[model samples]
Target: MTTVKVKLTHKNYDVKIEKGLHQAIGEQVRSVWQPRKVVLITDSNVGPLYLSSAQGQLEKAGFEVLPVEVPAGEASKSLTKVGEIISQMAQAGFTRQDGVISLGGGMVGDLSGVVASLYMRGIAFIQIATSLTAQVDSSVGGKTAVNLGETKNIAGTFYQPDLVLVDSDYLDTLTDRDLVEGYGEVAKTSALEGQDFFNFTGKIRSVQDIRDHAPELSERSIAYKAKVVMGDEKEAGQRQFLNFGHTFGHAIELLSHGSLRHGEAVAIGMVTVTRVFEAEGISPEGLTQALIDRLQAVGLPISSDLVGTPLFFQHMINDKKNRGGVINMVALAQVGQPIIVPKPLDEIRSMI
Candidate 1:
């Protein structure tokens, strides 16, 4: 097992990564938590596969486990769902002394973490990130959220988890689309980390390639992210680089009305933004094509049909990065050097 400790000013936690770690869920939680009631929050898709084993493990470890399964997908990341889960926990007589066990991918982790934070002013929660995206990105950052209207993660908080257990075994059951969707984050991180990491990810051409490299991939991304989050937990500064591909990506995603996955949209966002910046002489001339090639190598989309359209930029107007009518767009001077430039909304619109 490999462990990455996220040392934060407010708190510190460990992200344990290993295959077959799923079997140790109960024992692992027990090591960090006392015997108490826990709401095992999962989604419809993941519940049938791993919830019982996870619940049984927690139960065996002396936790009074109450299983709450929500319908799976992006729609589940909503205030309505958050309210429903909170109501369920309240009805179950849950308290801050209790905890939450998020069992699934990014959506489940995000939704579960939001509920745990809101319940009784906050409670302990652990993330068992099952998907490639969650394991590498969302699970480690302590950023929890739900979507409001068409915006992605517009509603969220930085509520750190007690622990994070990433077991790659659960990824075996994912569809090829689901598996490839995760590489979007891997690709985004590779870009932020620079040439070597970008070259490393460029070699990933198939699902088998991702599986072969999952451990190292998860470790490297999480490690880099932990370092970044430790320095800027609230996205006040350098941490904004992590949103390299997110601005345009989030807009394209909303425009698609959930047709595109988050990472898929990000893949497009990375390419789109880099091109716009390159055209404006902000990024290196060849950066966009390089991103296109690498992202395409992993079967990820590099451009969205909705892009360059009015609605696409319209969606971005609501981006969290907007301040005083200017968008703090993350641009790359090169593969390794990302900078945030506050561009006017009208200037961004000119790219279309």
Candidate 2:
């Protein structure tokens, strides 16, 4: 098992990475969560696979476990779903004293965390991430949210989980499409960390390959992300760099109408940013081609012809990173180092 401690200004928590930690969720979160009730939340897909084990573990640890299931997929991540879950918890007599156990991939983790934060002001939660995307990104950052009307994660909060347990075993159940989604975040972090790490990820082939590289990949991703998040937990400044591929990615995703997974969209978005910046002489020459090659090596999407529309740019203006009509686009000076480039919405629209 490997443990990385995230040190925030007001709170700190450990992101524990192990192969079988999902089976021990009750014991793992025991220290931080002394709960009157443990509300275990999972998505429809993952609930059947791991919920019972988590429930049994928590029950064995003497927690009164309550299970909640949300339909799987990005569409389930909505204000409506959040409201439903909150209402269910209220009916169950849950209070802030009862913690939440998020036991699935990114969607489940995001939805569960949102419910935990909103139920009775806020409550403790522990994330047992079952997907590569969640394990590497969403599970650790404490950035929780649900989509609002085609915009992704437009409503969320930064309420840290008590602890994070990442079990690589879950990657075994992912389909090729799901595998590609995981690589999206892996590629994003690799780009942000610099050329060597970016190149390192290019060699990975499948979920099993990722498992072999988990120690190195997970550590580097978490380190770069944690550094930025600790410096700016609320996205007030440096944290925006983690959005290196997110601004445009979000727009393309909305345009795709849930056809493209978040990471798939990010893959295209990163390529888009690289090309646009390179054309404007902001990034190095051939950067887009280089990213395309690496992204292709990992089976990620390089471009989306469907993203060519005025609606795409409209969504950019609505991005959370924009302020005062200026979009805070995260540009790579090269791979690894990021610079926030603010441009008027008109310039961004014209560039797109």
Per-residue C-alpha lDDT of model 1 across residues 204-239, encoded as one tens digit per residue: 877789988998899989988998999999989999
Taken over the whole model, the C-alpha lDDT of each candidate is 0.90, 0.83
- Highest TM-score: give the candidate number: 1
Stretches of model 2 off by over 4 angstroms after superposition: 205-208
* 246 Cα displacement, candidate 2 (Å): 0.8
What ranges in model 1 sit over 4 Å off? none
Q: Which pairs clash in the backbone of model 1?
A: none
Q: How many backbone clashes does candidate 2 have?
A: 1
Report model 1's TM-score to 2 decimal places.
Answer: 0.98
